[model samples]
Target chain A: MFGGYNRRYKHFSPTLGCSMNFHIYFPPSPPSSPSPKFPVLYWLSGLTCTDENFIVKSGAQRAASKEGIALIAPDTSPRGLNVEGEAESWDFGVGAGFYLNATQEKWKNWRMYDYIVKELPNLLAENFPQLDTARHLYLSVSAFAPIGNPVNCPWGQKAFTNYLGGNKADWEEYDATCLVAKFHDVSATILIDQGEDDKFLHNQLLPDKFSEACKKHGVPVLVRLQPGYDHSFFFIATFIDDHILHHAQALNL
Target chain B: MFGGYNRRYKHFSPTLGCSMNFHIYFPPSPPSSPSPKFPVLYWLSGLTCTDENFIVKSGAQRAASKEGIALIAPDTSPRGLNVEGEAESWDFGVGAGFYLNATQEKWKNWRMYDYIVKELPNLLAENFPQLDTARHLYLSVSAFAPIGNPVNCPWGQKAFTNYLGGNKADWEEYDATCLVAKFHDVSATILIDQGEDDKFLHNQLLPDKFSEACKKHGVPVLVRLQPGYDHSFFFIATFIDDHILHHAQALNL
Candidate 1:
């Protein structure tokens, strides 16, 4: 039998001037359907996590297989020893890309937004025939589903802050709320699941802000605030079956 | 702004004399109902996977939040490296527990069934207050809904193999079908969704076999085979909202 899991590495040059890695999960497809196109779920991990965090931890393959959705998990930050303090602390160093291009010196080379929205999707559409880039859904937005059980942790806060930088003014571009508006033009619906107790992004900051933005754009946003849960894969896995269904309804599959 | 995530670790001693690791996802409870009990979902990962896989990748939390369900993901095999081939190839090593206890020497100490059924649930109920152990859904049974376009992939194979493992003569103890009848005294309604193009598990094996088994026990099984898709999370994420509705209807939530 063929190996159920396969990995391919791509060399991506982020704005931060550091080469990064992105991993794609390709579920087995039939030979007859050589060029099968699958919906894409772009997953953004928290700080202190690389592309491998979701691949290794979230027991999502079964649901993915059941749903036939392709997963694109990208590195949180660009990495290279040349960058100063790249390996220093968990929040500011290599593992913490904050999904934004930093304007500050030493981290100025990083441009995660462009990388995620541009480079990564471009690469996946080109390399993987199974991925449907036109219908991509941001996992972060749909994370508000109560099944994942949200948490309040330091890693999430630092990552969100870093993505927004010190200036809240830049929050729009770096915030998923802002991104949702841009996605609305291309996609039909937006789904976001969050934990009420999540420590990092803070329940009110993300879903609330994003909901307002999505509302302004006239995009349908499904936001669920799971009560009492914390940050972990367990919280997410509990409702994977439902997540698949949500995407299906949006995609009309 | 609270974070939406939860993380916890549990130690389980199965019948096979080995200690196991399990990770669980507890959906948040309503603030007014701090001690509310919620339904539970037991997620089983494929080879080379641990509990963390589904937690991160499956995107189930959003759905779980909407339906108020808890998720449980457990390691594929026992840890600590005492087994002879624990460090061997990825298919049979530390990550590949095959969801079975090793009857063969050097592997005999691996008891995944006991860990999944008895020990893990016990531990989860004790540690996680949100989970409703008394009224939970046994996911190992058919209750799976295909999310998007289905692909012919290993997931179909794993699902079938898992289903068979649960029904096979000697493995009945590890089987969800048997356990449901033996302990719960309740017949379950199973829902499975598959894409016609899935490359790994032959779609026929599951729907056909499972349907047969359910018929034998006078249970209802719903199987849907989607077309034009490959294995990926997109399949499930697309239809997750509907699945949650199904669960809600089943549980009268």
Candidate 2:
């Protein structure tokens, strides 16, 4: 939207040993600049979402265009792997990668952590020269309805058990609440907008626990509990402008 | 989106002889006014669209909320009619109503013109006291990728043949280009934004014919050919703010 191009790309991910699809919203280049390089904002969508959900539903491109930030949305999980029981549940295998590298042998294809952190950036730098991925202002915004404390929730517990075997230590490696304690040197403040009426707020998305963990680590985090909102993309579209402006302010735009 | 509530309502229409579902985006009421009534904007979606498409994909609520205009979206056609070949083609039957009344016996259920122009207004007035449908300022913004001269296009020719029989005279009543010559006393200027790169621009969406007809009838019409755009919700989302603003100005918001 807003004079931006939502370009799709498919690249081989060695981290997951499969082809992955990703979408990037490249804001219209400035008239003055011959080849404009934009700071990137990586949007990690929630469960049951592909790369297209953020591009189509978020309505963030309007602000992203004004702020001169490119948006990158990688697919939630590896597809066409043909792993047993992979396509069974909507919240488990296919669209629910949880952005973690799986430790178990059966679910080795779920290496979204490495895919997002390493391969995707390298791919953007190599292929899309107009994207400024090397800048420190490049920010990543995870889901508002995320599995914040994944080690405690049923959706996370089931996914962790299947993807990382029965090791609790392996599960903590992927949990945001657990990781916040270990790595507390975040540059920008974390902004999370949670819908008050989200059905998964109590069980699946434990943002309260994540907020508590962030407080314990002195990590500046702002968790907004929006009233009368749900976990749907409508909620995202409602607050996406504020999120984009927040990122723009952090990036000193 | 944006603070507005997208509420769905189902009411039995006497015109179509079926229960039809429609959505209304009620802009959050002004703080000073306890019970508010706002001017309405009727958004008629293109082919293969339901009431939900404009609510979900158009991102119009953001502009509607800002402009204090409530949006009403009706379904494209009378669904679940179970006609002999109603469910066969995507372009002809199910989702392609063309917003016209049918004269043929087999397609007698297709009375979208009366449903939109007559029944829906009565339903809104009876049920929704918060909507200002009685006002002359209420505006209707039809599709940007509409079958403007439907009598000449393949999609419209097939649908008209099926819905209204083989009479060429019946098709002229439904075609916008043909109807524009007859109804030239429009209060506000007609604004149509057509995508230059739209695949169906040359064949289906003949805005040129409509513009010519409006000119011949001395109707104030502005047809903008947006470059590098296509016939998708993305194109609509880009220009929806402008449309909303135009309606708001006409309503004296």
Chain B TM-scores, listed for every candidate in order, come to 0.72, 0.96
- TM-scores of all models? 0.53, 0.97
Which lDDT tens digits does candidate 2 get at residues A164-191? 9998998899999999999888868888
Q: Model 2: per-residue lDDT, tens digit, B115-211?
A: 8888898889988999987885334444476678989989889888988889999899999899888888877888888899899999888999998
| Docking quality (DockQ) for each candidate | 0.12, 0.76
- Total backbone collisions, model 2: 0
| Residue ranges of candidate 2 with Cα displaced over 4 Å | A136-143, B137-143
Error of 2 at B96 (Å): 0.6
At residue B244, candidate 1 shows an lDDT of 61
Among all candidates shown, the one with the greatest lDDT? 2
Worst 10 residues of 1 chain B by lDDT: B144-153
Model 2: lDDT of residue B77 = 90
lDDT of 1 at B90: 67
